[model samples]
Target: MADWASLPAELVRRIAHCLLYSNDLDCYMDFRAVCPNWRSATDDPNNSTKLRFRPFRWIVVDEVSETHSRLLINTFSGRVIRKDLPLLSKYFVVAATLGGFFVLANKEPPHPAVVLTPFTGHMIRYKAAVPSYVDISGAALSGPFTGNCYEQYKAVPDSDSFALDFDDEEWGRTFVSMRLAVASGMCAFDNWQTTVAVPPLPLSLVPKISYLMRLYAIDPDKMFSDKPVTAFADLPGTGDANHLFLVASDDGEVFAIIKLQQHLKVFWLDNDNRSEEVEPVKSIGDRAIFIGYRRCISVSANKFLSIVANSAYYVKSTDSSLAIYKYDLEEEKEERVSEAIDSLNQGRLSFAKPPFTIVQLLSSYTVNVRESQLLEMEKLKRQQLPSVPVVRGH
Candidate 1:
C-alpha cells in the first residue's frame, strides 16, 4: 500500500491553501502540524501579507478564570489560545488595538503605555501622555492626547466682529462651527483613513432643519492640506437615541451602522456622485458584522458558513455577566449566542488587552473551529485519501 503521509509537497500545499480559503483556522493549523514538510509549505500569517483573511481570532482577557490570563479565541471554532503577561498585573487597562498591535496603559499614575502584539510578543513603549481614547487606521494611531472629550462642540471665534444672524448665508457658510463627534471606529481604504462624524448642527432657529452626518477622510502623511477636507458622504441623522458606528466590509466597502435601543440600522456609503450619500441597507449580502468595545469586524458568511449572514453580533452587559447576541438583519430579531461570567458588570472583556479596539487576523493564522460540520469536512478529507496500489517486486 502507498504511504498516505508520503503525498507530494505540492499536493500538501494545495490542501493547505484549500483549508486556508475555507476560513477554517483549526484545520489549517492541523495540516501544518502533520509533518515538517507541510509546516514549511504553509506561510506564517504574521509575516506574510498575501495570506490575509478576515479576523476570526480575538484577543480577550479571561477574567472569569483565576489566572487572569490573556486568551486568543476563534469564535467560529471554539479554540482557546492563552498567553501569560506578568506586566498585565500592573498595566491592566487596554487603551486600543491597531494594526494587530495592542496598546496597554498602566492604571496608576506615572502612567506609561506600551504597544504589544500578543501573538508575536513584540513590544514598543511610548513615554508621551496616555490618550483618553486611541484609534488605529492602518499604521497610524489617532486619539485625543490633549483633550478629555472624544467628541466635543467648540464655538467658532467671531473675529470679524460682525453680528451676523444665524439665518445669514455667511454665518451658515463661514461661521458654521465644525461639530466633531469622534467615530466609534476607523477604517482605511485606498490609503485614506476614513471615519464618520456628526456635522455641525444647523444654527437656524427654525425647527425645519435636521441634523446631518459627515464622512471625513484624511491622508495621514500630509497632516495638513489647503484644499477643503473631503466629505465622503452625508448620512441622515436619527434622533439622540441612536449612536453611530463605522465598519468596513471584506470587499472594502464602508458602512455606517446606527444602533438604536433594540435594532441596528445599516447604511452603505455610495460615492458615485459629487454629493456622497448613504443608502439605507436592509441586508448585508453574505456578511456578518461584529461590533463592541473590543473590535468592530465584518466577516464573510459564505466562507464561515456556521455564522449567519446579514447579522450583527454584539456584546451586552447585565448585572452579573456579559452576553453575546446575534442580531438578524433580515428577520429584525436577536438571539443570544454566549455568555461569560463576570461579577463586576463592567462588560470590559475585549478580544485584546485594551478595552475597545479591532483585531484583524490574516487568513494564514489558524483559529479553533467547534462546529460539527466543519470538523466533518476534515474527517471526510482524511477518509477520501487514496489507498496506495500494491506492487510486488519480481
Candidate 2:
C-alpha cells in the first residue's frame, strides 16, 4: 500500500480544501491532528479566506449577574470559552454583529456607537446623531438611522425646527409608522452613516399585484441620492409589511421571506433586466436562516445538522427565547423543528447584551495572544529552531 502518512503535501492540501468546503470542521481538525506534516498542509481556519463557514460558537453575555464576564459558547461542542471585555462591559451596549465585528453604542452621554472586532481589537467609532431617539438599523459599519424629526434641524440648526412639536395626530401617526418600519428589517445600510430606505408603498388606486417586491442598488459614495437603480418583481402572493424579512445568503443571493402567522413563503430574487421576478423557492439548498431583532444570518446547514435546512430560526421581539420552524417546500407546511432549542443549549441560555446579536468567534484577532508572555517565548523559539529540509513528493 502507498504510504498515506507521507502523501504529497499538495495532495493533502487539496484534501483539506475539500473538507473545509464541506463545512466539516470536526473532520478537518481531526485530519490536522494526525501529524505535523498534515497540520502544516492545511490552512488555519482563522486565516483562511476561502473558509466562510459560520462559527460553531458565539460570544454571548452571561445573564447571571454573579458572572459579569462574557461566555463564548460553541453550539456544536457545547464548549464555553470565558473572557472579560472591560471596554464592552463598562461603556457600551452591543447592538449588532456584522462581518465578524460587534456594533456597540456608548451607554452613557454623547452615545457614540462603534464597530469593534473583538478578536482583532480594531474599532471604528461614529459621531452620535443630533437626535437622541433615532432608531439605528442595519450593521454598525453599514446601516441607516431613521427619525424624520432630525430632518428639519439639518438645514437650519438654530431655527424653531428643533423645538418639540407633536400636536398633529396625522404627523404623529406617520412618524410612528416609519419608526415601526425601521424596527422591522425594512432598512438597509449603504455605509456607516447613510441608510437606503425601502421603496414607498403603492397606492390603493394602482392595480392589485399578487406579489410586489422591489430592489434598490445603493451608492456608498453619495450620502443621499434622489434616484437609485430600482427593479421590481411579482411574488407568488401578497405579503404584509409586518411579516416580511429580506435576507442575503452567504453567496450574496437576496431572499424575501414572508411569515403568515405560522406559515412561511420564500421567494428568491431573479434579477434580470428583461424580466425581474421573485421565484418561489422550495429549498435554500444547503442553507438555514436565523432571524432576530439584531440581524438575520444565512448559514450552511450541512455543518450544523442540529439546525434543519429550509427553516427559519427566529426570536420574537417581545420574547427572549429562540425558536425554530421548518418549512416544507413540497407540502407547503410549516412545523416546529424537533428539540431545536434544546439542541442549541442544554441549560439556561445566556443571551447577548441588549440588541442580542449573534457574532462568530474569530481566532485571528484575539487580544489574549497579543498580551501574553507566550508570544515572546514563541519568538525566541523561532529564532533558535533550525529549519527543516524540504522534501519533494514523488
Candidate 3:
C-alpha cells in the first residue's frame, strides 16, 4: 500500500478543502490531526474571523425556551446536533446572516449585541451611541478577518469593546438617503471593518423593486464616484422589502428570492456593468437555498446527499406555530421537513458561557476571553454605570 502521510501537499490540501466544502467540519478537523504534515497543509480560522472554506452552516436560537435547543444542523446532510447552551439563555438571535455570522442581543435591560461566529467560539460586542437603542443591521464586516497574521483581531479579555457613530458628510458623511441610512443602521466594531454599504435607491425603483440587499462586492467608496452608478438592477415586479433575500451561489452567481402569499420566486441577477440585468428563474437545478430572518445562502446539493436540490428552506412562522419548511422550485410547492430541529453531540457544550457550538475548529488566533471570564466583566460594566441622582423637590 502507498504511504498516506507522504502524499503530495497539494493533494492533501485538496482533500481538506473537499471536507470543508461539504460542511463536514468535524471530519476536516480529524483529517488535519492525523499528522503534522497534513495539518500544515490546511488553514485554520480564528473563531471570529471569516476565512475561505470555513464551515459555518450551523444555527443557534437567540433565547432558550427549552433545555435542549437545536444547536447545529447540516443543511446539506440533514444531520442535526442539538444541545442546550446555558449561556445563550440571556441572549436572543436577532439575525442569522451568511457565513454563520449571527447578530445576538441581550434579553435583559440595556440591550447590547454580540455578533458571534458560534463554531469559532468568538463574539464581538458593539457599543452603539444611539440613544436608548442599538441598530444591529446595515453594514458589518464584509468577510471574516483574513490575513497572514491572527494577532490583529485578538479581543481583550474583559474591557474589549467596540464603538459606533453617525455624522455629517462634512466629516465622512456619505451621499445617501439619511432616512434609509438611519432606518437600517450599521454596527461595525472599532477593530473589525466593513467593505459594503447600503446606497440610497432612486425614485424610479420604489414601485418596481425592493430595497437593495446588502452583500459584499459593492464598493462603499463608489458612493463618491464621478460616473453614474446603477446601484442595483431592478426586477420587473415589486417585492416586499421584508420578504426579499439575496444569496450568492457556489459558482458566485447571485440569486434574489421573493416570498409571496403562496410560493417563492427566484431570479438570476447578472453583474455586467454595461447591461446590468435581472432574469426570472424557474429552478435552482443542483443546489439548495437557505433563508433566515433577513439573510439567504445557497449551497451545492451534490456536496451532501441529503439536501434536496432545486429547493429552498425557510421559516414558516405565525402567531401560534413556527417551523422550517422546504420550498421545492421544480415542484412549485412547500413542505415542512420533519424534525428540522433535532440533536447530535451533547458533551461539546459549556454551560459556563455559550459553547456557541461544540464542533471546535483548530485556529492559531488566541481566544483572549472565554464567556466564563466575561461574566464578571459584564457585572463590572453594570457597576461602573453612572448613577443619576434626583434633586430634592421644594
Candidate 4:
C-alpha cells in the first residue's frame, strides 16, 4: 500500500536479493533495469551475500565434423541458443561465466584477436602479435582491456603472477612475451578483478597429484594489480576433468568436484592457506559420462550467482537430440543429482572409447610433439595392461 521508493534502502535491497534468487531468471535481468536503486542493490557487494543462489547455464561446444561445428548455450530446462563456429579457419571461446557475457575469439589470421561479449552485444578487436599463432585460451579477461596472457601457447595465464588493471579501461599487450607459470586449468574468481591463472609448467615440479586443475581467487578490487598465489589439489585420473566447475562460497572457501575413480570428490580449500578438506559428494560420476559439449552461461534472478552450465547431447536416433542441463547448489539434493549428475551419464557406455576426455592442449603456435614423445619414451618405461576382464552382463 506504501510507495516502494519510500521504503528503507536495506529493505529494498533485501527484496532485490529475493527477486534475484527466485527461480525466474527473466525477472532478475528485468529488475536490474527497472531503476538505478534496484541495480545498485543487486550489484553492490554489501548486499551480495545473495549472489551464490542463482542457477548456471552451461554452454556446450562440439565439432560435428572436420569443417562443420555446433555451438550451443542454454539452461537445463530446455532453454537454448545455438550457433555454428565453422572450422574453415579457427574459432575459440575466451573468457565466459554463468552470466550472459561470453568473450569469443576468431582465428582468421593476420588480424587474429577479436572478443565478443554476448550480453552487452559489444565486440572489440585487439592487435594480436603477428607472426605469432592464435592461442585464444591465453585471452582470458574480466572485462574489456584488463587481462593478461603469454604469447599464444608459449605460456600459461597465471592469476598469482600476472598483471591486471581492470578499471583503467585501457588494454595492455605486454604479456605477449611473458613466460609460462601456471597450469592449463585456471579459475575466474566470483569477483572479476581476482581471476586465477594456472601453471603451464610440468606436474613433477609440484606435489604428487594424479590429475591437474587450477583454482584462482582474486581479491575484490577494481585495479587488477594483485597476484593470486598457486595451490594444488588431487583428482581422479580416470574421471572427466572438464566436468569440474569452480564456485567460491561467501565464507571464503572454494569448492568443486574432484571427480574421483569411484565417487565424486568434493573439496573445500582455505582461501588463505590453500589447505584442503575432502568429502565424498556422491557416487554419481560412476553412472555419468562427460561426452557431448559443455559451456557456462550467466543469468540472474536475485544476486549475481555463477552456478549454471549448458551441455549439448549427441544422440543419433532422436529429433530432440540437443538438450540443456542447468545446476544450482541451493536446490534440493534430488534436483541437483537429477540435473547435474544423472543426465550426463544417460548414453550407452563403451570401454574401447575414452572413459574420460582428453582436450588437445591448444597453443598459439604449432609445436612438434615427435620430439616430446621421444623424450618421454627415453625418460619412462612402457607398461602394458596385465589382462582383460571378461564381461558377465551386457
Q: What is the C-alpha lDDT of each candidate?
A: 0.42, 0.40, 0.43, 0.28
Give the lDDT of residue 13 in candidate 2. Answer: 91
* lDDT tens digits by residue: candidate 1, 1-394: 6443677877887887766544445455555555558766555677443333323233343332335355564433334456676655555444333223455555554445566655445666655324333222111232111112122221112222212224455423322121111112232222323322111122221111112233322221121111111111112341232444455553445566665556777876543422434577888888777664223555556555456778887655433344556789888887766542222223434222323222222110111111122233346767899989999999
Answer with 1 or 2, whichever has the higher lDDT: 1
**Candidate of highest lDDT:** 3
Give residue 358's lDDT in candidate 3 (0 to 100): 17
The stretch of ten residues in a row with the least summed lDDT in candidate 1 is 362-371
lDDT by residue (1-394, candidate 2, tens digit) is 6555787889999877765554344455666666458867765667543324433133343332333355554332333455555666654443433323455555555555555644435676656322344333322132222213322222122242224434465333333222222222222222212212122221210111123322322111221111110000112332222244455554445566664455567776553322434577878887766543223445556655455666666532213332334566546776544222211122445232223223212110110011112223345668899999999999
TM-score, cand. 3: 0.49
CA shift at 151, candidate 1, in angstroms?
Answer: 8.8
Better of 2 and 4 by lDDT: 2
User: What is the per-residue lDDT of model 3 for residues 1-394, given as tens digits with 9 covering 90 to 100?
Assistant: 6566787888898987777665666566667666459867766666544434444444333222235243455544445555444545556544444334555556554555566655545677755311122222333422211111111121222433433334444223222322122112222232332212212222222212233333212232332111111111122332332345455454435566766555778877554422434577988788777654323445556665556778877644332333456788877988765322211223333222234221111000000001221343456678999999999989
- In model 3, the runs with Cα more than 4 Å from the true position are 1-11, 23-25, 39-50, 53-70, 74-98, 101-242, 273-276, 292-294, 302-307, 317-326, 331-394
Q: What lDDT, from 0 to 1, does candidate 4 have?
A: 0.28
* Candidates ranked by TM-score: 3, 1, 2, 4
Assess every candidate by TM-score. 0.48, 0.46, 0.49, 0.36
lDDT of 2: 0.40
Provide the lDDT at 377 for model 2: 36
RMSD of each: 21.7, 19.4, 12.6, 16.7
